[model samples]
Target: MKIIILGAGQVGGTLAENLVGENNDITIVDKDPERLRELQDKYDLRVVNGYASHPRTLEEAGAGDADMLVAVTNSDETNMIACQVAFTLFNTPNRVARIRSPEYLRAKQRLFLSDAVPVDHLIAPEELVTSYIKRLIAYPGALQVVTFAEDKVSLVAVKAYYGGPLVGNALSTLREHMPHIDTRVAAIFRQGQPIRPKGTTVIEADDEVFFVAASGHIRDVMSELQRLEKPYKRIMIVGGGNIGAGLAKQLEIDYSVKLIERNLARAEYLSEKLQNTIVFCGDAADQELLSEENIEQVDVFIAVTNEDESNIMSAMLAKRMGAKKVMVLIQRGAYVDLVQGGNIDIAISPQQATISALLTHVRRGDIVSVSSLRRGAAEAIEAIAHGDSANSKVVGRAIGDIKLPPGTTIGAIVRGESVIIANDRTVIEQNDHVVMFLVDKKYVPDVERLFQPSPFFL
Candidate 1:
């Protein structure tokens, strides 16, 4: 696919890297020449340096022949205008714009009609991140939770900790542990290496485990791998920025939420805006402030400040101060890997989450959801299998009969209202939402091709 991307920031740059590897022609447009040069030095893609919303810049970025235009500049106005320009001038088939402001998105339903905005898809990173954090809070022990097939099925990642039922037992014992619920252990990562899960494979402590199950059965399955903590009640957020504020608004009703902001004026604004949350004014990393707030009693401490160092410092402090679970938002890839396994319970990359959401539209098959697992090294995809055996490579075939790429495993199938855990004899029918886990993401294109229906049907 020929794709044009606006902005050379984190989201756009990461998308370029991901799509270029999938054999797509990617062209990036940005105002920062240095950032453009950096991307040009690393990946095989075209880059145009100028105001992204300008028509000349879009034309230089090959918008005329582009199959898709992704507008993700920092400015929401620039992104929206770029999509409109691409639609009016170039007639790009697909236009995806990343809009951050809530006001713009709230008005999108009424404002974006026909060619007014011309945005085929609107992605909000802040909204996506807020939803991501909410899921973690809702499910006490899961490191990652992703829904698929209209929320009928879920793919979850967790750490196997000591004192859990299945932590020291073989994978086959899961059925013995939970006789009624059906679940499949899709993949396991032991000491940072991918281990193909089998019935006989043993789950050691600290092993990162991935599993698929019906949405209702997720909590039961998760309890087997880790000692589930009590549902979160006392929550403390270290930043009053967009994500922190959004999360507090969602969690305030169900939990005891407290928000801390460094700026006094910003804290006052947040206090005025929030109804149930307690707003504090101080540095998040300050010992006095945390101690006074009773940080030791915090069930979950989330640091979402823009500065990576501040977030790391505050999260570690919270953990040492007896916070049960500490999650920090880190944008840099290296920082995420460094702190995740240590004191921090979870390290979230907003860019990775954003890319996963964007890839749902970029994918060729009838994909319903795409989740980046293990920091983008692996992916969990839910795609609809269309057509009959003669017309589709996946439909009307047994699970073992399909030619899946290496490091790929069929986890489950959502057929109509039923959820089926995939086995060798499990047969796939037309229109089934097949959930597959790929340990190696380079095989994504191959998997997408396998789910495509015959050209005659199109």
Candidate 2:
């Protein structure tokens, strides 16, 4: 696929890195020559230095025959216009834009038609990050929670703790622990290294365990690896930006929510917009302000301020002040590894969420959803099996018979409304949604080819 990406920032750069190795022709556009040069130096792709929305820039980036146009520049207006320009002047087949403004997103149904913005897909990083945080909040103690197969199945990551029922036992004991619920251990990470799980594999404490099961059975499976946590009730958020305000608005009805904004004007506006949330105008890092708000009684403290340093400091302070859990929104990928598991309970990355969303559209075959895990080292994919035994490699085959790539595991199969946990004897039928985990991303192309029908198939 020949793709033109409009942006040299984090999202654009990361997307280029992912696609360049996947046999796609990637060209990145940006006004900053330095950013373009950096990408060009690091990867085997072309880079165009010009205003992303300009027609001349698109032409230089080879948009005329590009398979897709991805506009992810920082400015919402720029991204929307670039998509329109790509569609009108270049006739690009697929146009994906990263739109941040809520006003534009709220009216996207009517605003993004062919006669309007011409954006085929809209990527809202703020909305994606907010939804990601909401899922984590819904299942306490989960390091990561991503759903697939239209929410019928979920992939959850949690750390195995001491004294848990299945922590020190072999993988085969999971069935004895929970005879009623069916689940599969996708992959295990011990000290940042991937471990292919076997029936005799014993889960050790502090091992990050990724598992897949029916959405309703997620909590039951999580309890086997760690002590189940009490549902969260009191929530405090630092930052009045889109993610913070949106989370507060959505969670206020169910949980006691409070928001702290450094800017007084924005705080007042949020106070009017949100009915149940308490809006405070003060510095989130202020020790006195956190104490005055009874931080010790807060169940969860989330710092989503734009500044990474501020979020890390405030979340650390909250944890030190006796907050049960602290979740911080970190922009830089490097900082995510540094802060998480130290003072912060979870470090949410907008880049990862955006990349995951973009990959869903870029992936080949019948893939419906893609979730990046372990910071892009691993991926969970939901792909619909098409064709039959004569044409497709996966369809009409048993789980153990399929030749999956190294470190790839079939976690579950979603057929119609039923979620079936994957086993060696389970046979994959036509139209079944196969949920898989890849511990190594280099095997993505191999996995994609497995679902593709043979060329001779009618």
Candidate 3:
């Protein structure tokens, strides 16, 4: 596939890196020559330096025959216009635009038609990050939670603590612990290294374990790995930006929410916009303000300010001052590795969330959903089985009979409304949504090929 990406920022660069190694032709466009030169130096792809929304720029980026056009520049207007230009001038088959403004997204249904804006898909990083945080708040102790098959099934990541019943036991003992709940251990990470889970594999303390189960059974499975935390009640957010304000608006109805903003005008605006949340005008790093708000009684502290340094410092201060849990939003990849598991319980990355949303469109085969995990080292995919026994590799095969790539495991199969936990004897039928996990991302192509239906299928 030939893809022209109209941005050279974090998301554009990361998307190019992911696609370049997957036998696809990737070209990135940006106005900054330095940014283009950096991407050209790091990867084996072409880069065009020009204003991304201009017709001349798209022509230079080979948009005439490109398979897809992805417009993710920082400006929402630029991205929308670029997608329109790609469709109107070049007739690109697929057009994806990253739209961050809520006003545009709210009207997207009527605004993004082929005859209107011509955007095939819209990726909203703020909305994605807000939804991600909401899931974390729903499941108190989960490091990550992503749903598939229309919310019938969920894949959750949690740390195995020492006191948990299944922490020191072999994987085979999980059945004995919960005979009624059916779950599959997708993969495990011990000290930042991937561990292929097996029957005899014992989960040690501090191991990051990823597991899949029916949505109702997720809490039961999480209880086995760590002491189930009490449901969150009080939430404190330290930002007035899109993610923070959006999260406050969504969570205020259910939980007691407080928001702190350094800018007085924004704080006053949020105070009026949010009905249940208490908005304060002060710096998050101010110890006096945190104390005044009774930070020690807060159940969860989330720092989502635009500045990475401010978020890290405020979250650390909250943790030290006795917040039960702290989550920080980090933009730089290096800071995510540095602060996670130290003072912050979870590190949220907008780049990863945006990329995951874009990957659903970029991936081959009939993949419906894709979640990048462990900072892009791993991926959880939901692919639909098509064709019949003769034309499809996976349609008529049992879980153990199909040839899966290394480090890949079939975790669950969603057949209509029923969620079936995958076992060796479970046979896949046509139209089943097969959910799988890959510990290594290099095997993504192999997985895609395994699920692809032959072209001759009637």
Clashes per candidate, residues 3 or more apart or on different chains: 0, 0, 0
Instruction: Tell how far residue 230 is off in model 3, in angstroms.
Output: 0.5
lDDT of each: 0.91, 0.93, 0.94
> Per-residue CA lDDT of candidate 2, range 38-67, in tens?
889899999998999999999999989999
lDDT string, candidate 1, 1-458, tens digits: 99999998988998998899888999999889999999999999998889988899888888898999999989999998998888898888899999899888779887676547788998998899999999999899999999999889999999998887887789999999999998999999999999999999999999999999999999889888888778999999989989999999999989999999998999999999999999999998888888999999999999999999999999999899889999999989889899997899999999999999999999988988899888999999999998897788877789888789999999999989999999989999998989999999999999998898876532
- List runs of model 1 lying over 4 Å from the truth: 455-458
Model 3: lowest-lDDT 10 consecutive positions: 449-458
lDDT by residue (tens digit), candidate 3, 1-458: 99999999999999999889999999999989998898999999998989999999999999999999999999999999999898999999999999999899899999999999999999999999999999999999999999999899999999999888887899999999999999999999999999999999999999999999999999999998899999999999999999999999999999999999999999999999999999999999999989999999999999999999999999999989999999999999788888899888999999999999999999999999999999888999999998888999888889898889999999999999999999999999999999999998889998898888886643
C-alpha TM-score for every candidate: 0.97, 0.99, 0.99
Candidate numbers sorted by lDDT from highest down: 3, 2, 1
Question: Each candidate's root-mean-square deviation in Å?
Answer: 1.6, 1.0, 1.1
Best prediction by lDDT: 3
